[model samples]
Target: MACCDDTCAPFDGASPAYRRALLAVIAINATMFATEVAAGLGASSRALLADALDFAGDAATYTITLWAIGRPLRTRATAALLKGLSLALMALWVLATTAWQVVVQGMPRAEVMGVIGLLALAANLASVLILVRWKDGDANVRSVWLCSRNDAIGNVAVIAAAGGVWVTARAWPDLVVAAAMAGLFLTSSVKIISQAAAELRAAAAAA
Candidate 1:
């Protein structure tokens, strides 16, 4: 399904202010991606690693959106389609890695997980606030908003996983959370691809 309802107006991709906002969000995501990846490795938390990948993917998506802005509608829709495929691929990678970690790794550090997850949550919340006004935009813009929204939600889940691991002294919570995050990625990507596909079809019909 599309991100916006039928009542919403078409997205304004040419807005200079919107482009500037996206640039800020891209920087935030890229910075968070580096921090989360390092922390995820140090803490040995699959959930953190998954979230790091998400941050990286979002950064790339926004970059693509920036490039496609002020271009043809078909071009923007194409970029969204590519971004959706990339997200899906990343989700599969996370799922595979999570499964491997479950089979081979021990419990991760709950304290580290909690601390880094909190940091990530803060970063994503800021991004969400910046992009909240564009949540109902066209497929390309809406995909960016969805990425921020999902990252925020995933960060909360990571914190919950940390708490669960701390209480139980087990890795199951971390693994489960990673798996759930992968599921979120998959579902959101499918939604984005569907919307982008519809937009492409409409653009074609109009031409």
Candidate 2:
């Protein structure tokens, strides 16, 4: 393995603006992670729990990005690869837990799901806006944008699941949404890992 990567069109992740945006995003994700964890436990909402896992993952991702900034290309790619793997692990955990939730068959509180989902959606939307300008970049940079976008999407799904749970009066809706979110996490993980692997390979070749 080489210490450098992406000599071509190497991104600008060291900018003051991007750093500030990343710090703000980190704060938001961390806050949301705590909020959703408490609410999910109180409300028995798997969807909210799944989304909370995402928030935790995003907080870690952004922290890694902050650390990788100004580092070598290989370092950034390695960080992204680690993030991707962690995301995959998180997803698998959610999927397995959601299956067990189905067996337990607890009905989630739809009102809590809807309200918390709305709050999460707003926070993720703000993150997306802050990172939009730098969305198209290297694997490490792109991963941050992808996580924010995924959060917004997950929030919408959580809201819909809340409606479904309310209408059907069943636990299936919450379980289904948690499973779907796991799928989303898997998909994003693949993309990030692929890009990061490519960067690593390119760096090795250049070395």
Candidate 3:
């Protein structure tokens, strides 16, 4: 088997370095979630709100990943499936909320979006770097990397939406970005679920 493959041996939570990295990431995500939720509400930015929701989901999943690190393949795969389902739920929530935002139309505060997006970007970038080395592995490990990657991408899009809103003075950019992030979340969820299912089968066969 290839290195870090779940079928043979897994080195996830076994490593002190990996555990430390995850702890730092969990702290970063929790802090960002609180900050962004407040800023998103104050600014009335759908993109920011979507990003904040993502941060909250990430915080929860990262904690799950830490818990499942050294677990059996089946256990880890089940955990990954839970993470994937949670992401799908969050995506649907964002889309529904964004549609409602369209009904009650209003432009967000561009300045606040820009400032908060920048701060979020920095936080996610730090998380990405910290988890870069442990990016590859089983479904449980891969899900953590995917979430971190999505957060960074979402932050960048939020920044772009801020600029677009500033130029056009419309909520379209914010709404569009939120919708796009929802799409990203769904796509990642699919990947995580697929891999986790396959691992589950493999684990059953081995058993």
Candidate 4:
């Protein structure tokens, strides 16, 4: 019974500290989402908009994670499954937007893209540092870590795309980066879903 209790405890019974970290991350991600979306629209950068959407998705996922804390393993797993679905939807939306931009938009403002991308990187890095300790926790906690990790990676790609656009004066780089970020979202969602499903199965078996 004690072993089962240990296995099921959210954040390994450090829910209080974990919840504080998540709250901070949620605030950072939410703020960055708003700022990046405005910059994305103003600069007409599909990649920037895609990353902004990712930030929004992460913020929501973190909120879900916060809700799951201190709950039973089954409850947390269910919350993670919902987060995974949301991530998949976000990827699909980004892919569609990228396609539309490919057909309609020209080269985005390279300067704006580079600057905003850098700012987003800083924000995500801060969140990553805050959540680094709990990166190996349960599915719900790991999902939050995965989101921040992917966001940091995507931020780097966005910066690279900005540089590519600056050098080539072309729209292809931005569209390519947007597609890549969509791929990241899809991949991470699969991982999160699998982990959550596994937890659910284990919980059922124990029951």
The whole-model C-alpha lDDT of candidate 2 against the native structure comes to 0.77
* Model 4 C-alpha lDDT per residue in residues 182-204, reported as the tens digit of each score: 77667767777788889999999
Candidate 1 residue-wise lDDT, 1-207, digit = tens: 112221222444658888888889889989988898788878888889878867876686667667864689899788878878877887788798889888896779999999999999899878778877866637646665665565677888899999999999999999998888777767877887898899999999999
TM-scores of all candidate predictions against the true structure: 0.78, 0.79, 0.79, 0.77
Clashing pairs in 4: none
Off by over 4 Å in 4: 1-10, 13-18, 132-150
Residue pairs with backbone atoms closer than 3 Å in model 2 (clashes)? none
Question: lDDT of model 3 at residue 193?
Answer: 76
lDDT of 3 by residue, 13-85 (tens): 4578878887898899899989987887788888887887677666766677678765687988888787677
lDDT of 4 at 162: 96
Candidate scoring better on TM-score of 1 and 4: 1
Model 1 residue 104 distance off true place after TM-score fit, in angstroms: 0.9
- The best-first sequence of candidates by TM-score reads 2, 3, 1, 4
TM-score for candidate 4: 0.77
lDDT of 1 at 194: 90
Worst 10 residues of 3 by lDDT: 1-10
Determine which window of 10 residues in candidate 2 has minimal summed lDDT. 1-10
41-149, model 2: which lDDT tens digit per residue?
A: 8998988888887787767767776787678888888888887788778777778878888888888999999999999999887877776666674674665545556
Predicted structure 3: lDDT = 0.76
